[model samples]
Target chain A: MEQILANGLYLGAQYALIALGLTLIFSLMNVLNFAHGQMYVFGGFVTYTVVAQWGLPFVLGLIASAIILAVMGALIEVFLFRPVIRKSKRDESTMLLAAGIAFFLDAVILLLFGEKQRGVPKIVNGVFNWDMRIIMPYDRILILALAIAMIAGFIALMQYTKAGRAMRALAQDRVAAQLMGVDVDRYSMIGFALGAMLAGLVGGLLVTITGINLGMGGPTSIKAFMMIMIGGAGVISGAIAGGFILGMMESVGLTLLAAYGDITYLVIFASLMVFLAFRPQGLMGKPWG
Target chain B: MTKTYAVLAAFLLTIFVLVPVTISATGRWDLYYTLTSVALLSIGAAGVWLTFYIGRINIGQGAYALMGGYVSAVLMTQAGFSFWATLPLAGIFCAAISVLIGLPILRLRGVYFAMITLVLTEVTRLTALALSITNGAKGITSIPLPGELSIFGLTLIPDFSTMDSPKPAFYLLAVTLMVLTYLVLWRIVNSRLGHLCRSLQQNEELSASIGVNTAYLRVLAYAISSFFGGLAGAVFVAISQSIYPSSFAVTDSVNFMLYCFVGGLGYVGGPILGTFLLYFGWDLLSAAKEYQLLIYSSAMIALMLVLPNGVLSLFDRKGRRK
Candidate 1:
């Protein structure tokens, strides 16, 4: 039971990390970046290259991946998303554009790295013990800690930072924010960069836990989407709560329903259907205006 | 207008009749299968176009297709029902299932709905992998070719297995189905229900306020969409003679949406043209070997950017200018 709780918490933290970026982008741009998971996979690959190939410290590799992906994310927004947004009158094409970018990213990664799965070595090779029965690994604990720290730091930045204020303003009222001298494009870029950085950070952390592969992007993106829906679309706090709810559900569901094997997806989708039927706005999401 | 449609129908009939005869005469079996697959895909894409007409981006149309395939496959293999008998049954079954699933999902707006639908194929695929009836990933194989049609022991068409080359037969069946599917779609587009659906696309809330019964209309369109998807799927299984979960994966669902987008969502005929071009276009790029996906996806992005309304829009502009 303790093990399940710890594992669930660990899973929740990772999910929250991924969900943070997704909700940020959704709130700011009114678009979901389908390529977000591809960026996450790219982060893991970057960490693998930096730590495993270049013999860099794991911490430096994580930081490096975050910075690299943040820049890439900004560039993607400007080049791929911006042009399409400008051309189309409606936001419908954004999904296709993101899918296009995702396809391109997948193709590029497949070409560059082949299909082999790669893993980052654990930063600190040791185990943590609480008494005799309850055991936790140093890496898992570090993941949980770093996830909390990063999430808290992001919350602080969003609440206190000037750029973050501008983002909030833009999200609330685009035209009014523009009238107030906030550059919509710049904030959109920042939103993408920040969101990408979080995804990269989670990816780097996840590599040590689950390893990295090209195919991880599609499933991870779906999981993030599920989390956002459960938490409340475009609500940051809701995303965090939804992540934890989903993680616990998976861990508990797996423990009880072990014989089912991969029924978690079915359960998640079923619950999502039920949840949407009753409350489409989600638990924490503001109703669409 | 009637004269123009008559000429168009005659032209289509001539092409469909002549092309297969020419291909078979030349003994081009590969071209036969390719054309057959394209026709089958266009039928499925037409279903997707209906939901698009109702302002819903249905990324899960492939799920209905998969369901349709399995329904036909299961009924044929297990119950010994003839394939011809199962086609409409499969479509009806899928339509019923879509109505059940679409009720709750259609409430969410925009990306939230799209995102939910995104995982649908995955869920269905997983279910197929888990369920015993679906054979759990091994999938139901050795599915017999469609049985013959007869009236009181008088054979109308021979069984597919008896044919020396089933490709030509399958091609003709597929083309006939495609023609029928598009005709239905064309009729729908011109009907009163189609106009109500179009109103939802422009301003759903306003339409609802004006007593459009928007929910019922959305559900109706979705049911018809899934019905067509199922029809296409059943036809697909008839051609392939087997049904596998991966045969209609999430990528196929995405491709279905892309077909409508690339064809021009503005018109009913868009998916027919879009599926053919994208289908042949992908095959033409097979020579690029490992770079095919890279080049293909790049082209997809470049096309969306260059032709936002789709390839049909170019003709649309020309028609307007003239």
Candidate 2:
């Protein structure tokens, strides 16, 4: 039971980070980046290269991966997403573009890294026993701690910084924000970059906990998208709550059902149908006016 | 429009007549098989196009396809049913499942619905992997070849083992199915229901205020889409003689959506053209080996940006001129 809780919390941290990044982009940009998972996958590979293959310190590799992916995020936004943001309808065109980027990244990753799963060595190798039977690894704790710290830092940044305020303003009302002298374009870049950076950080952290592979992006992206839906689209805090909900459900389902743990996703999907039918706005999301 | 369709029908008829002759004469069964797969995929893509017409993204068609494959495979392997019998049953099964799920979730519009459906495919895949009936990861293999279609053993179509390659008959069957699928779509788009569906796409609120049952229309469109997906999957299983959980992944669902986008979402015939081009185009990229995906994705991005209406629009513009 204790193991289940620990595993759930750890998984929840990764899901929370992924959901936070995805929802941040959705809130600010009003577009879903289907390639977000590819970015996360790339981040994992980068961390694996830096820390595992290159024999660098784990912390340095994490920071490097985050910075590199943030920059790539900015470039992708400006080059791929920005030019087409004004074209046709936002949903269809942007979706196609994001899917293109996703496929492109997947191919690029496959080309660069091949099809092997890579793992990073542990930053600190020790297990702490809370009780006689309950054991926790230092790396797992580090992942959880880093996840919370990064999320806290992100929230602080969004709450305190000038760029963050501009982002919040733009998300609230685009035309009004523009009227009030907020540079929509620049803030969009910043928001996208920051979101990608969070994905990268999470990717790196997840690699340390679980190995990274080429096919991880597609499923990861879907799960993160689900978290956003359950938490309420465009609601930041909702992403966190949704993440924990999914994580707990998965862990508990695995513990109780064992062989039938795969039903967790089906149950979530069915409940999502029910939730959308009855309360489409989700837990933290305000009712759509 | 009649002249264009007449010409297209003649062209399709020419291929239908010539393909078998050429394959048997030259022994290029691979070409016939590829064309057959394209037909099957196009049939599935056409279903997606219907949902697209109704202004909903049907990213979960893969789930239906997988379900259809399982239904057909199970019926064939265990129940000793003929493939022809399983085909309609697959479509009905998928359509029923879609209506069950579609009624509740179809109310959520845009990305919300798309996201949920996206998760639905993954869930279905996992379910297939875990289920006993699906054979649990190893998948049902050596699924018997479809039997002869006959009334009282008249043998209208030869059995799979008796055929030289099964490609010619499969191609003809797939083409017949493809033609039927599009005919339904074309008829739907021209009928009153199709107009109602198009109206929902344009302005759901206005349609709803005017007493159009928007929910019913959405569910109907979705159910039809899944039916087509299931039909295609049934055909696909017959061609491959097997079914695996991994056969239809979430990526294929994404690619199906892409097929519609690249084919031209404005017309019923778009996905048919899109699926053929993409399947063949991706095959052509095999020479690049590792860089194939990178180049393919780049081409997709460029194509969407430059020709948002799809490759068909190039012909659409030309056809409009004269």
Candidate 3:
């Protein structure tokens, strides 16, 4: 039970980071950014190239990933999503553009990073064994700490910063925010960049533990979607809650259903569908928000 | 109406007669496979288009397609049913499944609906992998070719195995199914049901207040849409004589929606044209080799950016006006 709780907490931290970025984008632009996972993978690749290939410090690699992804997210928002959203009458038009960007990023990653799984050297060595009950690697403990710190830092930024307040207002009501002197386009771009940066940070953090690969992008996006759905779409607190709940479900499901092979995910996804059917607003979100 | 008939005749002649003859004369037998795939994919895209018609972003058509393929495959290989008999059964099964799935999820907002449907494909794929009847990861293979079809002692279609090459037969089957799917789609779009669906699309709350059975229309449209996906999948399995859990995946689901978007959601024939162009355009970009996907995706983004209404909008002088 202790082992399961530890595992779930670790998984929940990383999963919440991924969900936060996606929900951020969704709330700000009302564009369900399909390319968010690709951005995450790109971040992992960036970190891999920096720390693994270039022999740079892991901290430097993490910073590089954040900066690069933030820039890419900003560019994508300004060039691709903004114009498409402006011209198209229907809001869903951005989905096609987002999916296209996903394909584009996937192709770019394939060409640049290749198809092999990539990992950075562990920052810390040895295992953290506690009474033979809670066994986790030192690297995993460090990653969990970093992930929590990042999440806290993100929360602080959103709660206190002027840019964060502007973004929150934009997310709450775009037209109202615009009327109140919020530069809608600039804040939207910033929100997207911040969201993408969170995905990058999580990617970089998790690379040491799970490794990264080209194929992980789509599944990551789907998993993130599940998290956001569970938490209530576009709600920060809900995203975190959804993340922990999913993490717990996965950890418990995998441990208990070991004899049943790989049916844990199947069950989780099935139950998620059923759950969403009953509570479309999720546990914390407003209806149709 | 006469002009419309004439145009339809010319279009049919081009696809059914001229294209085949040209391919044969040019000795481009490989083109048959490509064209058949386009037809099959467009059939799925038509279903996506239908969901779009009712103001929903359906990213789960791939689930129904995979289900349809498995249904046909299981029945034909395990139950000793002919492929012809399994085709409609697959479609009906998919429709029934969609009704169950659509009832709850269809009520969500558009983005939520899209996200849920996106996960549905992966769920279906995982289910296929876990289920014993789907043959797990190895998938069902070496299924027999479609057998002969007859009605009242008259043979309508011969067994595929008896032919020198089943390519033409498969192509014809796929194209015929594509045409029939579109005709049904066209008919639905023009009917009173279609108008009610449109009202649901425009404003669900308003439509419900104005006496539209909004829930029923949404579920019905979704079912019909999934039925098209199933038919496409069944035909595809027939062509390949195999079924796999990953046969119709998330990418295919996204592409179905992309077809509707790229073709023009406002027009009935949009997905067909979009599939043809995008499929062929990707094939044409194969010359780029390693950069094919990069170029194709870039072009896709640029297309969406510049032609947000889709390629069909290029021919429309006044743009899409409801």
Candidate 4:
């Protein structure tokens, strides 16, 4: 049980990183970006290139990847979301456009990375064991610490920053935000860029834990979407709650199903379906005003 | 869907009729399975279309069809039941599962719904992969077709099971199931229930205000869609003589949605037309094929940018005039 909880928390951290981006987009744009998984994968690939291929310093590689993805996120928003939001295309447009971007990204990754899975060497090596009693990797511990710090930083930024207030303004109403001199469009671009950076950081962390490839992007995106949905799309709190719940579920389920030699993605799917049915906005999503 | 259906119907008819005759005449034919594959896929896509028309994008439809295929095969191969009994059982099982799933999935909107159903689809596939009854990822293989059914010494089964070849099967598939689908959709579209779904789609609040149980209606649509999905799966199982998880994945569900969108959402012909163009391009752009997804993505982006209403609406000036 202790192992399960610990594993779940570790897994949950990964989900929180992924879901944060998804939740941010959902809250702001009312559009769920399907290409989110690709953004995360791109992060992993960037980290791999820097650390694995170019033999750059690990910290620089991670920071560089996040910054690069932030720019890419801005570009994606300009090319895709702007047109849909401007034209009042609403949710349908988002669905179609997001899927298109994901498809394009999936192909791009395939072209760039080939089909083989690639993994980056752990940023911090060795395990922290209490005299071989409670064994866990130093790398994973770093990830958990990083995840907690990131979430805390995010909460601080959201609550205290001027940029955060502007983001909230835009989230409530683009027209109202613009009228209030909030520069709604600019802030949204910032949010997209910021969200992408978050995804990249998560991606980099993920590659240290497991190999990533183009094929994993879509599935991972789905899981992230599920987390955001359960967490409540427009709420930061929801993202955190949903991510941890999903992480715990996944870890526990995977471990239990090991006796059967495989965990049924269908069961997880079934659980997600039940979750959707009961709470359309998700578990932590703020009710409609 | 109309355009997709028309194009698919024409293309399959051509391939079905021409490919075999051409092969017999010239004798260098290699792609014997083209028509069979196209027809089978179209059938599956048509089932996909049914869900989209109801204003819900069901990515899990492929899973339901896969379920139908597996259940049908399992019953016939393992349980020693006839195809007729297993076929109905497949449809029922699919409907039951969809209803069970619909109870929850219909609650979600936009990406959540799409993602959840997609996960369900992968789950269904994984369940099949994990189940001993499904042969545990090795897949249910070598399913036997009914040889003949004679009541008063009359043969009902095709002499050699017409599904074996791409041509006769295409005609049989296109004319029979396609026509049935067309009629069913036409009837539904012209009915009051169809109008309600469209109304709900246009404005959920207004539809709810008018006292329509929008939730119930959505579930109904989902169940109906699942029925066809199972039916298509049964036929596919018959044609392929095997069932595997690869045939139905989360990707198929997403592809199904794209096909419906391209065909034109909420229209009788959208899925048919969408499936047609998708398969046509899928056939035409077989080079390296990995780039096919990119090509598909580019096309979708172009379409969304150019015409959000879909290509079908382009030629439907008459419908617009109405």
Candidate 5:
């Protein structure tokens, strides 16, 4: 039980960070950016290339991932999403645009990073075993701590900053924010950049533990979607809650259903469908919000 | 009306007669496979297009396709049912299953609906993997070719296994199904039900307030869409004579939607044109080898950016006027 709890908590922290970026982008643009996972994988590769291949410091690699992803996010927002959203009559046009970008990024990641799984040298070594009841690597513990710190820092940034206030306003109502001098386009770009940066940060942080690969992007995106849906789409607290819940489910399910062999995800996904049917608004979100 | 019928006849003649003759004359039997694939894929895309018409981005059509393939495969192999008998049964099974799934999720808003449907394909794949009945990972293979079809004392279609080459027969089957699917789609779009669906797309709340049975219409459209997807999948299985859990995957689902987008969401024929162009375009880009995806995706992005309304919009003078 303690082992499952520890595992869930560690998984929850990282999962919450992934969900945070996706929810942020969704709330801001209503775009449901499919490329978000590709962006996350790109971040992992960036960190891998910097720290593992270039022999740079891990901290520097993390920063570089954040910076690079932020810029890419901003450019995509300004050039692809913004213009398409402006010109297209239907809202779902952006969905196509987003899926296209996802394909584009997947291809780019394959060409640049190759298909092999990659990992960096562990930042810390040593297994923390408590009475043989719970065992976890020191690296996982550090990653959990950093992930929590990043989440806390993000909450602080959103709650206390001026840019954050403007973004919140834009998310709440684009027309109202524009009327109130929010500079909608600029804030939208900033929000996208910030959202993408969070994905990158999580990717870079987790690279030491789970490693990264080209094929992880689609599954990551689907997992992030499940998280957001469980919490309530576009709700920060809900995303975090959903993340933890899913993490707990995964940890417990994997352990308990070990005898069944690979039916855990099938059960989880089926239950999620049933859950959504009953509560479309999710646990914390307003209807259609 | 006469001119329209004439033009339609001409188009049918071109596809049914001229194309095959040209292929035969050129000794390019390989084109049959590509064209057959396009025809089958477009049937699935047509289903996706139907959901889009009712204001849903259906990323789950592949689930129904996979289900349809499995259904046909199982019926043919285990039950000893003829392939002709299993085809419509597969589609009906998928439609019924979709009704069960769509009742709840169809009520959600657009993005939520899309997201849920996106996971559904993966769920179906996982289910296929976990189920003992689907033959686990090995999948059902080496299925017999479609047998003969007869009504009363007359043989309507000969057995595929006895043919000199089954390519033409398979191509004709796929194209005939494709035409039937689109004709049904076109008829629906022009019918009162289609108009009601369009109203649902425009404003579900307003439509509900004005006495439209929004729930029924949504479910009906979804069932029909899945029916098409199932039919396509059944045809695809017959062509390949095999079924796999990964046969119709998430990428295929996404591609179905992409076909609708690339062809033109507003038109009935959009998916048909879109599948033809995109499939052949990918084949053409095979020369690029490793860069094929990169180039294909870049082209997709560029196309979306440049022609947001899709390629069909280029010929839509009325759309331009608006």
Candidate 6:
């Protein structure tokens, strides 16, 4: 149970970071940004390239990689999603655009990385010894800490910063915010850029703990996706809560079903299906339908 | 009357006429491969196109394909069921399972629906991976033949001893199921039911206001899609004669999803055309693994930017011009 709790919090941090970015895009732009996973995947490779391959400082690699992807995110918004955003294509089509972007990103990564898993340099190389086998990686703890700090910082920004207030207003109503003299488009771009940055940071943090691979996007994205869908698309705190729930569910469920032979994945998916069916609006978001 | 006959002649000439001449001339046995892969994949692609028509996407179609393939493959390998028996049984089995999944899932709109279906595929894949019934990823191989299955005491097998290649089975796949699916889906698109589905796609609220049973129609579409998917899986089983969870990964599901989108979502020909072009291109491009994902990603980005309506819609718009 302790391990499950720790695992949940640890993995939940990763989920929350990615989900935070996802929620930002969804709330501000009303887009799911399906390719968010691909960005996360790319972040890992870029971090690896900078820190390990180029012999750069780890922090510099994180900062540079995050900035680079943030720029890429802004460009993608301008060239790709801007038209679809204008067309009133609805959430479904926007999701497809996200899927396409992720697919393209993965294809690029696979081409460059050769489909092999590569481990990133651990940010910290110590362990937390709560029990005999309950020793924890210092980097994992760092990841969790980084995730919480990011969210806390995000909350502070949304509440305290001028840009944060503008983002909040845009989230509620882009046109109304526009009428109120907020640059809605710029806020949207900022939201997207920050979201991409968060995803990249999470990707960097993730490789330190779990290692990295081209295969991470589809499955990990689904888990993060479940969090967003369960928590409601645009809610920040909801992402955190949903992440905890999924991580707990996954760790506990995987443990329980290990004794029952198999069918654990089916159970989790079936549960998610039930959640979407019964609680479509989820906890934080309003009923879309 | 003549038009219908002409179309049938084209189909038949391609099957019985053109194919044989090519086989005789080339002696390469390549057309058999192209024909079968196209037929099987089209079934799955069209299944996805059903969800697309209803404004939903089932990334879990891979789950159904994988499930049906594994189920039939396991049964044929372990239980000694002939390939012929597995075909309809597997198809029916998959359709039934898919309907069960669709019941709750069809309620979700847009991306949520897509996510659940995507998760559903993962669930199926992981469960299949863990199940003792599936040999825990060792996969079921050396499946039994359909050699002795007879119609009125006339055996279907001409050469019973050799099980070397899947070429003949591929031709059988092309002639038998693929053509049938094309005709059935074509008819469905033109039916009153088809009009109702398109209406739902345009505006679900509007469809509901006009007395269309929106839920029922979506569910119905869901079942039809699953049925075709099962048929495709059965075809895949026939060709490969073995099954593994990896073959039906979520990537395959997404590829099928892209094919439908790339070829144009609302048409039968879209899947046929898109599946061949995209999948075949993927096969050729598989040579350079490192650059493969990069190319696919760039292609997708370009497609989104340049032709948001998809490759098939280009021809569709032109045909409409006439």
Clashing pairs in 1: none
Off by over 4 Å in 5: B1-7, B317-322
User: Relative to the true interface, what fraction of contacts does candidate 1 keep?
Assistant: 0.57
Q: Across the candidates, what are chain A's individual TM-scores?
A: 0.96, 0.96, 0.98, 0.93, 0.98, 0.93
Q: Give the per-residue lDDT digits (tens) of candidate 3, residues B237-313.
A: 98898989999899999999999999999899999999999999999999999999999999999999899988888
Most accurate candidate by DockQ: 3
TM-score of model 5 (CA atoms): 0.98
lDDT by residue for model 4 (B122-216), tens: 77777887878888778887887644556678766554354554445434543467557667877776799878877866777788998989888
Which ranges of candidate 2 are over 4 A from the true structure?
A259-261, A286-289, B21-27, B152-154, B315-322
lDDT tens per residue, model 5, A123-209:
999999999899999999999999999999988988899998988888788899999998899999999999999999988998998
DockQ for the candidate 3 complex? 0.80
The residue ranges of model 6 lying beyond 4 angstroms of the native Cα positions read: A84-97, A111-114, A130-134, A173-184, A261-264, B1-12, B155-166, B286-289, B319-322
Q: What global local distance difference test value does model 3 have?
A: 0.92
For DockQ, candidate 2 versus 5, the one ahead is 5
Per-residue C-alpha lDDT of model 6 across residues B1-322, encoded as one tens digit per residue: 7976797788778776787677869896876777678778888888888878877877778888887787678777778777777777777888788778788778777767777777777777787788889887887776655565578978666543365765865577556676788788889888998899899888999999989999889988988888777767766766666777786887778777877777766566778777877777766777866677567667666765665666766776697999
lDDT of each: 0.87, 0.86, 0.92, 0.76, 0.92, 0.77
lDDT, candidate 1, B109-156, per-residue tens: 777777778888889998988889999788888888987999999998
* CA RMSD, predictions in order: 1.8, 2.0, 1.4, 3.5, 1.3, 3.0
Each candidate's number of clashing pairs is 0, 0, 0, 16, 0, 7
lDDT of 2 by residue, B1-322 (tens): 8997797878687668777777779977688878888888888898888988888877888999999999999999999999989999999999999999998888777777778888888888889988899997899999988888898968787788787667777888999989888888989999999999989989899999999999989999999999999999998998888899998989888888888988888877888788888889898899988788898899988887787667777887897999
* lDDT-superior candidate, 1 or 4: 1
